[model samples]
Target: MDSRLDDARGAGRRRIPVALDGLEQWLRIPSISGDPAHRGDVARAAEWIAARLAKTTGAVRIVRSAHNPVVLARVSATRPAVARLLVYGHLDVKPPGPGWTSKPFEPVRRGGLLIARGASDDKGQFMAHVAAVEAWASIGGPPLDVSFVVDGAEEIGSPGLKAVLDRHRGLLGADAATVLISDTKMAGPGRPTLTVSQRGMLGVKVVVSTGREGVHAGRYGGAVIDPTQVLAAAILRAARVVRRLTGAGRPPGPTDADVRNGAAGRAVHRDRLAERSTTCGALTVTSFESGSTAGAIPTTAKATLDVRIPPQLNVADAYRAIAAALRGNDHPRVDLQLNCMASASGVLLRQPPTVRQNVDRACRLAFGRPAASISSGGSIPAVDLLFRIFGRPPILLGFGPPDDGAHGPDERIHLGDWANCVETSICLMGFLSGSVTAASTQHPDSSFSDTLFPHGSRGTAALL
Candidate 1:
């Protein structure tokens, strides 16, 4: 084992309690961004993070927006040649759903796990970055310049974050080829993973209406054109078209090769792909409403659908297809209205030798195991926006374990994984700083040959 790794392991053991204490305190604030009532709590959480970052030997500022404030801090190096690393994380959490063993606002420790609303989704995972920075600052800071951007409205699709980045682009400039984000999780405990790509997402709510008023089913059953029935037929047609477009029920497309290659890289752990695809079904049909009474015909019907597209797919094209499908239906009485459309562009991680070597070496030094690159099915819109604004590929790495139950009740972070994350963060910083160097000398822009998968290879059909 390397001396630095030994030091990091020792430091991580000593700092676990401190990190846990901080996580508990941070999780206690109900910074739910979607709820208007929790605005004060959101600001309070931002203030707490800003104060914490200010304690370091650097320039820290609280950048506020109309929605929530972002904590931006910087530690400069003696020379510009040294790489400048950007670290980002979120402070706000989702609303706590029912079924928690304890109160969502109160962090509880039981069976070596910390349970709270934001304990795992982001608050715990991102705090590991804070803990890592704190550890470095405690030992006189890093050799390279480092910047931290902590946001508070990530749970709400980061509405104001792009504007914030655009406004402060000059202050956040960087020459580094990569950025680090700890907002995602590993496949599982002891299986260190790096997320290389994330599928794009588009959410839309469609409401169909026909008649002006609801009528008794007995009198209107045969006479009136029921909007609910018409809407259901339209939805069915849209579903079949989407299935055909995705090549779900037919032979795989050429893109299947890429999917399989991505899956192979991600399948280092058992059930990893299965876990990633678990959201495919649950991502759609968030809510629905139809009949007002059991025996009455509904005048209006509404349903919200969340569509997740792979990195290789086009989002705008998918929306157009959906709109055409809804409009082409021969329901004279039915009208389709699109409520909201949130689309995220996809990004692929740069597979530079330096990046792969650094991530692999760092994971080995920290956990005595090699790390694997994986594609995440869920979407992180910030990843696309940040990369576009800064022109740097953001590396998604974290210490979260599977079944952490983010956005669900009883959200928790594994204590052992938390300690491992601390060690990993320290080792990654040291590795990137050249405490350890790679054997290969490849340019950061070098592109590797993409391997395609058999399952995702078939081309999608024209749904429109």
Candidate 2:
């Protein structure tokens, strides 16, 4: 172990309390971006972040989009020779669902866990970076220039963040290395992780309408076409199209090798060959409406589909396939309307040697174990967007533990893990400072193979 790493870890342990305290305060605000009622609380959270950043050696600015405000802070290096690093995370959290043992907005500490909305999803992870910056400043500043871009609309798909990035391109510019995001999970409890890729997302509300007016089943049994039947046929066709698009009945993507070998595979029983090739779609019909009453043969029908596509798949092609499937049906009165369409963008992080080395070293030094490199199935538009705008591969090294229930009921952060994450953040800053220099001077294309687990592991941890 390096002496500098040892000293950094020691410093991190001493600053755990500071990180936890900040997390507690941050979780108290219900910065739920989806709900308009929480707009004030969201603004307050941004202000709180701005104030905290102001206390450090940086120029903090509160830039507002059409919706929420983005807190941008810069910690300039003492000497201009140092490189610039951009650190971004979301300040907003998903809306709290029901069935909470404690209040969602009011954080509660029970045993060694801090339970609250946004505790692990983002607020806690984001705060870790803030605490790291503060710690570095206290120790006479970091070796490189650091900038923070904390947004409030991340939970809502970063609707207004692209404009924000475009507007502040100059202020947010850097030496074109890698941006760091602490908004994902570590591979396992003790295993640190660096997320290298994320799957794209396409959400479409497929509405199938058949009739214009509600009529009694007895009166319109043969006369009117049932919208429900038409909708069901359309849904089935859509499912078939999705199955074809995902290459179902075949081996999973290359990334699924680890998942297939892990506990996930054991539970599902890999020996069951039929299930091995099955590619289950996460298509969810969130809402359905047809007919006015239970018994009456109603007039209209509608259903929404939420589709998750892999990085290898194209969202537009998938959409066209689904549309073509629906077109095959000859229901004269039925119509399909696409409510929303979002294309996903992804970047491969395997080629960047510096990013991988820094992430692996930082996580191992901080947690006393090897860190895993994994790809996320969920989408983070900001990651891809940042890569496009800055031409830097973003590394996601988060501290959130498994089953933190982010975006769900009783979302919480393990107190101990939260503290460890703060340490990890500090270690990452030092590691990245070194990595940037090494990467800048070394080969542009270098790939490292990751072997955290054997291939074919199908478990929640592996899949997620």
lDDT (Cα, tens digit) per residue for candidate 1, span 365-433: 556666766666677888988787667678788566555668876777766557667767766776766
Model 2 bad stretches (over 4 Å): 1-11, 247-281, 435-464
Error of 1 at 455 (Å): 42
Whole-model lDDT, candidate 1? 0.68
Off by over 4 Å in 1: 1-13, 78-81, 175-177, 245-283, 435-464
Q: For every model in order, what is the number of clashing pairs?
A: 15, 13
lDDT of 2 by residue, 114-207 (tens): 7789887888888888887777677567656788899888876788788887777667656464588888766655455676566656667666
Worst 10 residues of 1 by lDDT: 446-455
Best lDDT among the predictions, by candidate number: 1
Taking every candidate in turn, the Cα RMSD to the unseen true structure, in Å, is: 9.8, 7.2
